[model samples]
Structure formats: structure tokens, C-alpha cells
Target: MAKNSALIEPRLPRGFVDSEPADLAAVEEMVAKIRHVYERYGFDPLQTPFLEYTETLGKFLPDTDRPNAGVFSMQDDDEQWLSLRYDLTAPLARYFAQNYQDLPKPFRSYRQGWVFRNEKPGPGRFRQFMQFDADTVGAAGPEADAEICMMMADTMDALGLAGKYVVRVNNRKVLDGVLQAIGVADEGQKLTVLRAIDKLDKFGPEGVRLLLGEGRKDESGDFTAGAGLDPAQIAAVIDYVGGKVPSGNEGIAELDAMAALFASAGYGEDRIRIDPSVVRGLEYYTGPVFEIELTFTVQNEKGQDVLFGSVGGGGRYDGLVSRFRNEETPATGFSIGVSRLASALKLTGNLSSRPATGPVVVTVMEKDRIADYQKMVAELRAAGIRAELFLGSSKNMGKQMKYADKRNAPAVIIQGSDEREAGIVQIKDLAEGAEAAASITDNAAWKAERPGQYSVPRGDMVDFVRQIPAVAAWMEVNARP
Candidate 1:
């Protein structure tokens, strides 16, 4: 007798998700649109490995205790520590540094891939997610930053978010000046201040003030230690954040310069604007930073309406590649969280509501006549129609129809003995049947419409199916020449 086997239950790690075909299709559609916009702006596609040497990917994440603190890391057999890339930008920086001599100046490239981070996951916050990035490396002027802002606006418009979103722009230099004016010059303290400011939308001004001063206790009574700044320092930080100080004035001026750059290129404030509160949470950003925020409001779990918030952000990082070489290499780019953006589109009803439909299924009525069914499926496929033959165990007609429905098949090719003897095939429009059955009130009219099924000669089966409006429209869009 064989020993009893142990069955292992399949599971996915927290913050990771598996996508179904419909979800995958929807995401692919969104990515294609974004990629089109990037390509239009002359950005070429590039890809990098999921893993990189820990030393090669320099430590730049904000609020981390160590270099690989925020990333998933593992040790190789050769006693070298490797890490999963926390963001696409880091790998790009490594690539540029390694091949600087052979690459073009101001190398323009776009990449779309999954990035990993090791962090506590929350609602809509995953450890692994897709990011689409476009960067101009080696461009050192505000013009490059302005172009990125403009391209971000265009990308949003391409994704059908033209009037519903705004790109908030700011500069790190202005923030640095603000800190200098406030007497809070410590590097760790600056990060603490940035993090507190980042919580402005959630904690509000008063809560943030508490955080900047002593500390803050949330509604759940969990305390987040403050930056330990005095009252005067807190006031200075708050005034700068509110754009009421000299350094704040300098930040506003820089934003105005960027806005003018955009306007000269014909982009207006409708798409991009300067906001002092826009401090991106990344340590590597040395110059201007911008965030794409959706202006629309949605209800949260607490049943209160709130803004959709930022879906993407980027800024100039001149020091990333400087770590590799002794010289500064300016680069700026933008990245959109693919899943979050898709979720926003869905919530706003901008995404397609219909689930992706599968191919038409040719039912197997006569098991002995499987060859005939295969022939019909082949003809449909050859005519640029998506179709498949039933390859199930059940031979019952009712079961076959149920299987077709389960497959989301638009229609089913039926050739029973009677239809075969009549030298014809039946094309049962399952979609039409469901729609008609749901709405038809008059039995006589329903019978007269014959909305569910049609019969055509065996030789004309493909042509007849092609004439159906739904199938015809699909073919017009997806069929190859």
C-alpha cells in the first residue's frame, strides 16, 4: 500500500495578488495607452533584471535605517548580498552608470515592470506592484523637468483623466532653504519633517503641528514619536510649509519658473501648478518634484468623502549616478502605480464595465462526429474569428451549452444530427439570448424576434457569424489584414 500523502494548501504572500484574465486584459489596455504617450514623447523602452547586486543599487530610500532596509534582500552562494529593486529608477541609475561611455547623452527611456518593497501592507498598499517610468538622464536644466511635467499631463489626458487631475510641482532647494531658515539642519530631522509634511492630507495641519513638535497619538492611541523640535522651530517649519517665509518664497519662485517653462511650451496651469505642500517622500530628489493628484472625490471606508489623492510622482535626482562616478548626472522621471491608477479609473466609471469575452465554442453534439466539429472551428479561426471546439467529457447538449456560457462565449456553433442532415449549422447567439430574455416582456414579440439563434448553410457558417454586429465590430478592431 502506498503511504498517505500530505496535501499542501496553495497560498499567496500578503500584499501580493494574482490576476484573472479579465483583470490582466484591463491592465494591459491601460499600459498600452500610457506606453503610446511615452513613445510619442520620444522615449524608448528598456528593461532590467528583477535582482541586482546590493552595492550596485545604492541606498537612497527615505526613512530607512540601512541600505537594504526597505527592500527584500537575499544572500547569494558567492557571499554577496543581492536585493530586489525597490523602484525602477534605481536600476536605471545603475544601468546608466555602468554604460555611461556607450550611451547617448540625455538618454531617454521608458520602462514598465513590477517593483518590490518590504513594508507593512495596508488597504491598496501592496509590497509588489507595477510601475511605468519614463526618464531623461543627463538633462540638467529646468527645461527637462518642465518637459517631464508636460509629458505627465499628456499621459494623464491620454488615459482619459484630462480635466480630473492636477500635477503639483515643488523644489527641494526651496525646502532646504526653509529648513536652514528654521535652524533644523540635521539630515535625520529633515527626513522626519518631510514625512510629517507628507501626512498633511491625512492628519491635517493641527495633527501635523503636534507631530512636528512633541508627538502625535492617533485615534487608535498609537503614538508616533515627533521630531523633538522646540516651539520656535515648529513654528518656522509650519510657516514654511504654509508658504509664509523667505525660503517658502524662494520655493514659490522656483515653482513659478517651472510654470512659466510649461506655459512657454503651451501648457497652462489647468494641467500643472506649483504647490508648496508638494514635498515628495524620496531622499534622492535634489531638485524639482511633482505629483499627479486626481481632483475627484470618493467615499472612504469611514463613509466620508475624500480626494483620490496622488496616483503618480517623480522629481530630479542628480546624485543617484554621482554615487557611481565622481561627477553629477542629472535625471528626472515620472512613474504611475498601474494598479492604483486602474482602480481609480474603475471607481470613476472611466474603465470598461464589460468583462472580457472568450472565444465562440463549437459544441460537441455527436462525439463520433468530433472531426466535423473541429472542421467548423478551424474555418471560423481561419476567417479571423476567435473560436474553439468543445473538448469536455460530457456529451449532453445542455451541458455543452452551459460550458459555452461558462467560457463567456459570444455564440455557440451547433450542428446536431438534424442540422447536419439539413446541410446547415446553427449559430446560437448566447449574448443576445441573455439580453433578450432579460428584457422581453411580450412572448409573441420575443418569438417573432428570434433574437437568440440563427441557421445558415454549413459552407457559409463563418460568413454568417461575421455578419453578426457584435462579432463584426470585434473583427473590425482586432482582426489582422
Candidate 2:
């Protein structure tokens, strides 16, 4: 044997994580909540392969400032280039084009999955994350755009973020028309201007003024090159973003036309507003573009209100499928940054509910009682309760209970030869044990107050555990679709 041995790898790379029960439950809750809202909006769920041919998914996302890729890439078995999808929307475009004739016209679907980008990582930014996306295929017009906006609002509400979030809407057509009016005909230059305008909220009008004209120097002393627009062109872009949210009846006239359709479907004014600032970064949008902006503000590193930026955004891309199909079919959609939203919620204290680690812990009463402990967990499982036997070997019974406490087990069941002979099993409510642990310094007082912890008939084990659901569960069930 060598004098020294090296340790095996045991940690994950940056931007990757494993969620324990406390963290995972919060994510699942939000996912279910958003999916419920999507289904209510007539969007069905969809999933696709993680890998795609690089040729099939062309370069369209602008302003990410990475190589011929922010996407992770590799070679296929035949040496064909392939890449992981950077956005859920891009994969949908590929899916639609591949199965155009088989699927219904105006095919509507919602997809939630992980995406990858090889972009630089920063605070609150990650290379791998999950997105919840929904798209309406084969629909043009503002009605589809309005539907997406409404779904965005409702989805926020469902996720307990209605009061905390807002959906800002703008028509890419409107912005494009504005650009055309400004005398920008070069297709490449047109896109550069559009992307610069999208960041108006971040850079402000003056900052955007620099992004449009010459390059602008950020406060961090970094330089960003402009899209090269003249003063006249920059002003037009500025006016739209800074424009008012026209009020009263005439103010929201264009918006009302779309809202009325949702009204008929019973979704009302609590969601969506016809704001002008929602120009997104993508050049593919043919009509409206919208973003889910968190209305609640958190201080940035620079200690300023940034409106929580966009946790998710999507818009009408009528030309995406056109690249594949001979005919141009219009499609509109929205995507939620599951990772970003999860991060914000965790920061803001919404995802703070701590659930009991699991159901019962079958304490290892003695070395000989392993079989008995295993049988106790089996009974709990049969009764629809989560449970596990104490896998750790310990001689001290007190240490076993301490282990149960660390596991956050709601209850601990113990069996010894004496209890087995009497057909009774000892059950301690760890949920109650926690409350008992926090106070009552005297061990005698602790034991006395836990009057609920006592031996029960083997047949009554399920009943005893059922009584503790309210004590251990941190979430409620809502079945309404």
C-alpha cells in the first residue's frame, strides 16, 4: 500500500446543486402551481429530448455576448455537431417544424425542463437551470399575444406571486414599426437597435442613448459597444419605453380588445397591463413581446431598485417555424425562469416553510431488533406514511433519539422484546418532541408534557401517525383545476 492515498472527488461543480427535501418541496410547489395555471389556459404539457442537432437549432438569441455559442456543444456518433438547448422555446420551434403536419394547427403546449448555456456566470446567474414555458402555435394577431400575457399574470397569481409580480407588455411590431419610421433598413443593424432598446430599463434612457450611439462605459468601468444609431433613432426608442401607461377607457383601448376575450373566460383585470417597456432581446418576435417583472424590489449590489428584472419572458415569433416549413405559421409563448424565481422566493422568505424531514423513524432499540425495526417501517409504508429504519448503529438510546431529531422525523417508533411480547409498540411524536425540546429544561417536565407519546396496539400505528399530519405538513392540497 502507498504511504498516502488521495481522496476521491465528492463535490459538484459551480452552478450545479442538489436539493434536499426542504428545498425540493418548494420547487415542486411552484412547478405544480404554474402548471395548473397553464392547463387552465388550455395549454397541454410537453417534453422533448435534451439533445438536438446544431443545424436544426440555429443561432437567433442576440446580446448574450458569447462565442458561436452560449450553448454546450459536442459531436454526435457520426461526428455531426450537436448542442444542448439554450431555451425551452427554441426546442419547441424544432419540435413544431419536425411534426408540423401531424399536430393540429394552433397547437398549444406548455413545457417545463432544464436548459443549458455556456455563458459567463455571475451573481444570480447560472449555466444550467430549468424553465417553465408555454407557446401557442399557428396563431397570429394580438389576441394570442394577449392570451400569453394573461396566462403570465395568472401563473404568477397561482404561484403566490400576483401581488409581488407584474407582466409588462409591448408589441414588437409596434417597436419594429417605430424603427422603420426611424430609417433603419439594414437587417443586421435593425436587430442591433432592437436589442439595445430591450435593455432600456437596466441602462435607462441616457444609458441606452450611449448603447445606441457609441459604446457606453458602465459604472464598473466596463465598455459596451453601441449598435451605432443616430440621435434621432435613439430618441424614438427612448420615447416608447418611457411612455405612459395610458389610463381610463381610451387609454387601454388596444389592450381592452385582448382583455375582453379573457374576461369572457372569467380572467379579469387583476392580471396584465398594456405597458410599453417590455421589448425583449430576441429579434424573432413578429408582434408583441412581454416579460414577467417582479413588482417587488430588492436592493441590488449597487443598492438600487431594478424591479427584480425579468424572471421569465416570451412573445410572438411568427417566423420561427417558417425557417423549416414552406409556409409561415405564427406562434406566441411565455417562459418562466424556474431557477431565478426559485432563487427570488428563497431570498424573500416565501419558500421558508420547514416540513418535517419524513414520517416515522424506527429506532434501533437493540442490535437484535433490526428485523423488528424494519417491520415497523413496513407497516407505516402500508399505511401511506413515509418511514425508515435507523441505519446508524449506536449503543446509547438517547443518541438514537438525537439522530431521529436530526433527521426531522415526525415520529419515532421503538420496539424491544418486552413491547413485542405485549403486542404494543412505543411511539414518540417527534413533531411534538421538537416543541418539547425547545422549552422545558427539566427532562422530567419534557417527558410529562409529551403525554401523547405512548405505546399503542400494533393495529393502531396508522391511526397514531395520521393524527400528526397537521403537525408535520407545511403545505396544503388544492385540487381545483
Candidate 3:
């Protein structure tokens, strides 16, 4: 056996991640746009500390059962066990109840923050991720749910997911009625049954049928024990799911009511949908549960074409505040999974990937002229151009150009011996020049390429640097999304 050591392996435990800058940038854009839409709808931005008392957040969260049960947990100075929030909705509930007297009757607010869950991370699941949510408290009708659905529709349109996305809305109570009709007495079991039903797309009708009755043998050769119900009971669950669709009788009633609300408010079914598979996982949801599903397909982890599925979801938690205030306070909210949304947008070719800055590297030709190089950099900076000086000790001109290539520099300003003698500054259109060089052609032929490299006087650096906006515009026009 190998020698034992106290040090653990250098790796992340299954569900955690370190997001890349590209990923964060796309998400940031989406979050900013969504925030603007929320603010337009009159929701104030509110923030609360990530750490809160265990009693503060309450215990109805689907995964909150015991210590370190669902969320990351730690003990406080006063010996109170605190867990990271599982969702923004719970914390908003806590915020409303604590400041009940101070806040307006219908406290409207939105928050963007990181939420944690200590659950198994699969294809699109992670231990920690960011959520953007908007909520309205003190509202007690389907109108509240209706507003959330409207916001959901607007959010998709604002994010450019308009034609490609749809919102599936349903009431948790409607599901409860289905469960009651199916004879699932316990709420927990009903939720489990709903979760299984939600996976109908993944498992298909046969798989769901097995899950409703005895159990299922999945593609991975794993057996998921079913609710263990009789044939008649299982049939009811199957029938309920089958009955849900955009243009159906029961679904049409709910959709018609919501459509009338949005239609009066200027949104319509051209973007919204009513699908029964939207059984959201949060235990706090007491009313309508809405999910934004991507109709497009993206490559899965296995490089297979799988419908990317729902990218965001939320529902009404009418009883969340009751956990603390001991009185009913109805609240409805929507959350956008920014990271997943960004990923889907990226795969669908909807997100722009332009690296914002194109550096202008001033190549140093003379070691003694370091001061002149510094002056050139200063001039570029003064003109509001992204500029830097080549710090490499290499004297070879070819190697200096290579450095600019690595930096993705769009222009390389060269005041070489020849140019210095001519009283002109040799400027290379590094972006185009580099691209030209990368093509399969002779290096000398590429180097002597006349259309790219230009010469200007030393005093004209700013004017020359100003050409980038046009270059960027031209590139944008020529490129395909």
C-alpha cells in the first residue's frame, strides 16, 4: 500500500466550480439587463447578509432537513448553526418579515446573489451559482403570479431569448389536486412523485410509468425505486401529465386567465407556454410555478444533441413569511439561472464574444530609448487607447511582433531605425496583419503585405489610434452571429 498522508487530493469535491471570465462576462450582461427590467417594473434593489440565523430562513426548503443537510453549514459564535441560502426567495421572505412594519404594504424588491446547495451536481447543477430574482410581497391573488409570468416573458425578450424560449406555468395546488386524485397522502411523497413526473422528458413515458408503479431501470443501469403504487393510482399521475399542453381544455383555462392578464398588460402567448412538466423543486411554492425553457438544442456533456431544457424557474411561496411572522404573507418571485442562460446563449450563437479591448503595443527598438517608449505609451493612454509597451528583452523584430500576436494587439507602433531616420512612425495593423500572417502563405509575402502596415508622423498617434472604432465596426459588420 502507498504511504498515507494528511494532505488531501488537489481537486474540487464533485459539485463545486471556478467560473471563467468569459462565462462571467456573459452572465453579467444578462444580469444587468434583467435588473434593468425589474427596476422598470418598480422593484427596489435589496441586499441582505449571506449568513443568517438558522431560525431566520426557516426549515421548509426542500433540502433543509438536518445539519449540513442541503446547504453549506457552520456554527456561529453564539452556537447557532447557519447555512448558506439555497435560493433568493427564502432570504427575501426573511427580509420582508423582519422589516414588516418598516417596509411598504406590498414590498417589491429584487436581489442578485450566490446561493449554495449541497446536492449532487449533474449536467447543469453545481454546488454554487448566481441567481437573479424579483419578488412582490403582500399580494394575495393570481394577479401576483400573473405579474411574475409577465416579468418572465419580458425578461426573455430583453435577454434576446424572445422567439426561442417559452414560460411553462402551473399552480402547485393544481398539482396537489392531481396528487390527491392519485392517492398520494403525504406532501413529501407528492413532491417526489412530481419530481419524477418532471423528468418525463428525460425518462420518457415508459420510464415515468415504471416510476409511478414499481420502479425504473434507467439508461445508466441504475434502478430508481418508485412510489410503489397500484396500477390505477399510477394511471392517474400519467393522465394528469398527459392532460397538460398549450392548447388544451384544463391548461387553456389557466392559460386564458393568464393570457388575458398579460394581454391587457401588453404580453401574449406568442412567447408564454403552459406545460405540466414545470413542477419546480422548491418546497415553499404554494401557488403558480413558472419555468423558462429553451426550445433550442445544445451539445450535452457527452457531445450529444439534447434539448437544453429549462434554464430558469421560480414560483409563489405564500407561506414562506408565515414561518417567521406566524401569519400568512403571500409572495411570488422569478429567478434566472444566469450562468446556464449564458451557456445556452453562447451555444445558440446569440451572445456576442467580442473581447472588449484591443491593445496597441509600442514595440521597443532601442534599449536607450525606453523613455521615448514610455512617452508613446502615455500618449496612447491619454488618447483613451488600450496601450502597452513590449517588455521582453528580445531584440529581434520578428520576436517582438510575435509578442504582440500573443497579446491580441490590434496595432503595433514601431519607431524603428529606418522609420526614425525617415521622420515617420511605422504602424502595423496587427489585427489584420496577424490574421493575414496566419493564413497559409509565404512568411515574407505576408510580411510585405502593403494594405495592413502604414506609416504616420509621431504627432499623429492619437489620430491613428482613433481608427480602431472604425476597424471594430467593420469587423462587426463582416462577422456572422
Candidate 4:
């Protein structure tokens, strides 16, 4: 049969990629650790939908000029614009407002889900990515922000990144104060200046100076329009980012309060520090902002040594929920970029990159006795073993073995007519067999050792399979809460 000429190509969009089993497993592990920390801090889990009204996301959409600017969106049949959430915080604001009457005064919640962005993808950037966030709504004190910073530090410690990461805290108010002090009143120019300051780490002082002034061009010759700040304004912004923290303003007072709380809570500068440069990129941040930055240096794709920078960040957004409600609803939270953090962990050798093991596959040896093989699988499953009966067209033992190996299955169960008559079943430990094959050079010895193949009573098959070292270890690890 001739294949259809117009078979659509199988591919993902540039900014997205499929998560394989191992990748998923790594993310799951990281998320679990983060969840435990959040729960320990008394944050309950809350989940919002993947889509929200375009306006509900606040400034991301509903623009007739560029409906999908920075966010994926579409108009519904009823002519209402809906958009995939760009971040978890916006949805949380909507949710909190919608359920304000029933919710507690200070609603503390944590959520983890995928967020979508309609932006250009680059190294470590994706159109769809997972973020694990914890937020406290209705909390107006700087202590709330301090707790978030400390929680972030604890989360890093929980992830085995104890001394390798630091929670850098700052205040948007402080940045605003500096801008005010510099006599920059235009909101557009203020945002441009803040964005320039945010790039202090990515580009050094000179690069940021260019961004604060005329503009800067990248290695690809792409020009980015700057804040158009005068020399004096640029110098002022640079001086502030260079650790000359401003005082006397509410921002400075809040930072001082947060710093006191941090010291009282025993989080030293190594774990959590008051950094003057951590002005988060988000515009909604009304006050304190913080970021978790990995301190360890790693070689980039170009083999250049660079610090694995901010993996996660968040800040107080006192105005987000107010858009939904008539009253002021202050909120503070932090988000961990699951994919980026996983990548960092893998590079730092903290995240496991091992191939995921598959379930135990029971081979269908005799077509007529397929029921018998299935029964064995059921027994294994009933005993809490991950087992599945192989159902494929080829009945050849070699093909069956190959399938089992490809699955990375710890072992495979076989019950042929002869073995059935003898009331015995064979279990092959694939991992052990591969290891033995590599070490045992002689075919004779390989056959004699039968390294990982075992014949046991039919009734004891489940127990024998469970005893395989690889299977045993996997079960033990998975059995934990």
C-alpha cells in the first residue's frame, strides 16, 4: 500500500518539547520535595484551570492590536477572549476574588501546573512550562514577604541545594524610590529602567549602562531599545544596583523589617540575603521581591563558565486581586520554574537522569494459554507489583525478550506449555543479564551461569519476580510517601 502523500509531519512547536519518562520522573521527584516544604509551612494546595478570561490575566491580552502578545489566546464562540494562563499567580488572584466570601482571611495556598507564553523560545526557555508556586493572600506585612524568602531558602535546602543556592531578596518599592529620587516620572521609562537593572546579572555594568541609556546590541546584532536615560539618570540607577540601597522610604523600611525577620528565623546571608539588585521583571510586583539563584558555576552550551542564575522568583502584588474585588487584597508568593530547576539540578548532579524502569512484562508464550500468563500478571499486580501481560503480534521469544529489554523492565515472566506442565515459570532479570553478559566473555559460561534467568514454582512466580534486586529497589523507593 502506498503511503499518503500528505501525511502531516510529527513535531512539536519550537518552544515546546515532549517530556520523556525519565524527564517526567525527575520533575515529579522535584515537585514532591517542594510540595512537602510548602505543606510544612502550612500552605494548602489549590488548583486553578489552565484557561482564564483574557482580561482576567491583566494586561496580557484583550488587545485588538496584538491579541496574542506575550500570551496564547483565542476568541470563544460567544466573542469572549480566553487565554492560557501565563503564570499561576494571576489565576490565583482571580480564584481568591471569586471565592473571597468563603475563604479564610489569610488564604495560604500552593499550586503547581503548566503555564503558557507566546514568546520566542531560547536555551532553557519554553512556551509551556511548569511552575510550583506558594502564595499567601491578604497578608500585608513585610513578614509575609520574609516568610516567602525563608520558605524559598528552606525549599532549596530540601532539594539538596543547601549551600549551593541563595534566596536574594529585594523590594520593588526600593527600585521605585530610586527612580523617584532620580526624577524619572514617566511610567514607561520607569519600567525600562527597572528591566535594565534586572539585566545586571546577564550583562555587566557596561551592558546595563547601554540599556539604561541609548540601547544595547547583542552578539547577533539585534538591537534592544533602551530607557533613553540621561548620563546622570544612568549613573544613579547603576549606583543603586551597585548596592547603594536607599533608605527612609516604605520600601527600605520593609526591607529592614524582612531582614530582621530573616535574622530571627536563623536564615543567614548564605541562605537568604537582602540583595539590592533583585528587582523581579514582573510589573505587578508592588513591594518586596525575591529570587532563588543557584550559586554553582556550570559550563554553558558554548563551554563558557557561568553561574546558573535565578531558577525561581516572586514578589508582593497588592494590586492584582484588587482588579477583581473592590477592596485591597495583598498577596505574596514565590514560584519555582520546574523545568529550569530540573535542568539545573541535572547539571549539578543533584537530579537523577537514570532511565526509568518499566513494569514487569509477562510474556505470552502459548497463544491458547494467554489467559494463564494474564493470570500471573494479575497475581503480581494484586501483590502490589507493577506487572503487565505482553500482547503483541510476534510470538517469537527473541522479539518478546527485545520488547522487555526496551521497556527497561527489571524482569519478564515466562510460562510456556512445558513450564506449565512442570508447574514452573521462568523470570529473567534484564538488568542483571545485561551486566553479566558484558562481564562474562565466554558464551559457554554465559549459558552455564544463566546469569539472571530463574525457574521457580508457578505459584511462587510473583514472589520470585519481586525478589529481583532492581525490582526490589524500585518497589522500596516507590513505597515511600
Q: RMSD, model 3, all Cα superposed?
A: 5.1
Q: Order the candidates by lDDT, highest first — what do you get?
A: 4, 1, 3, 2
Q: Judged by lDDT relative to the true structure, which candidate is superior, 2 or 4?
A: 4
Going through the candidates in the order shown, the clash numbers are 0, 1, 0, 0
Q: Which stretches in model 3 have alpha-carbon errors above 4 Å?
A: 1-14, 64-68, 76-78, 244-256, 298-306, 354-358, 391-399, 416-424, 435-440, 470-481
Candidate 4: residue pairs that collide: none
Instruction: State the lDDT at 314 in candidate 1.
Output: 95
Model 4's number of clashes is 0
Question: Where is model 4 more than 4 Å wrong at Cα?
Answer: 1-5, 60-68
Candidate 2 on 1-481: residue-level lDDT in tens?
5668787789887766676777777788778888888898788989987888876667675643443477788997899989888788778988988898799989999999988877778777787888889999988666887888888887777666757876777666666666667788887777777767777778777877888898789878998788888887777778767773324433245456766776776665455666676777777877777888887777887787667768999888888888888888899998889978887777677665575356567888678767767877887777666788888868577898888777777778877778889998888876566665787788888767774477898778767776785423521342123
Best by lDDT: 4
User: Candidate 1, residues 1-481: lDDT per residue as tens digits?
Assistant: 3467776689899999898877887888788899998999999999999999887767687655565788888999999999998899989998998999999999999999999989889898899999999999999888889889999999889889889999988888888887887788788888888888888888888888988888899988999988888889888878867867463355556567788898888887888987778888888888899999999999999999999999999999989988888999999998999999999988877676466767889999899999999999999999998899999899898899888878778889999999999999988888788788779888998778767898889988988888766677668868696
Cα lDDT of model 4 by residue, 241-335, tens digit: 99887668889999889999999988889898888889887678899999999999988788999999999999999999999998889999999
Each prediction's TM-score against the native?
Answer: 0.94, 0.89, 0.84, 0.96
Any runs in candidate 2 off by more than 4 Å, and if so which? 1-3, 63-68, 244-270, 346-352, 447-452, 470-481
Query: What's the distance in Å from true for residue 408, model 3?
Result: 2.4
Question: Which residue pairs overlap in candidate 2's backbone?
Answer: 70-118
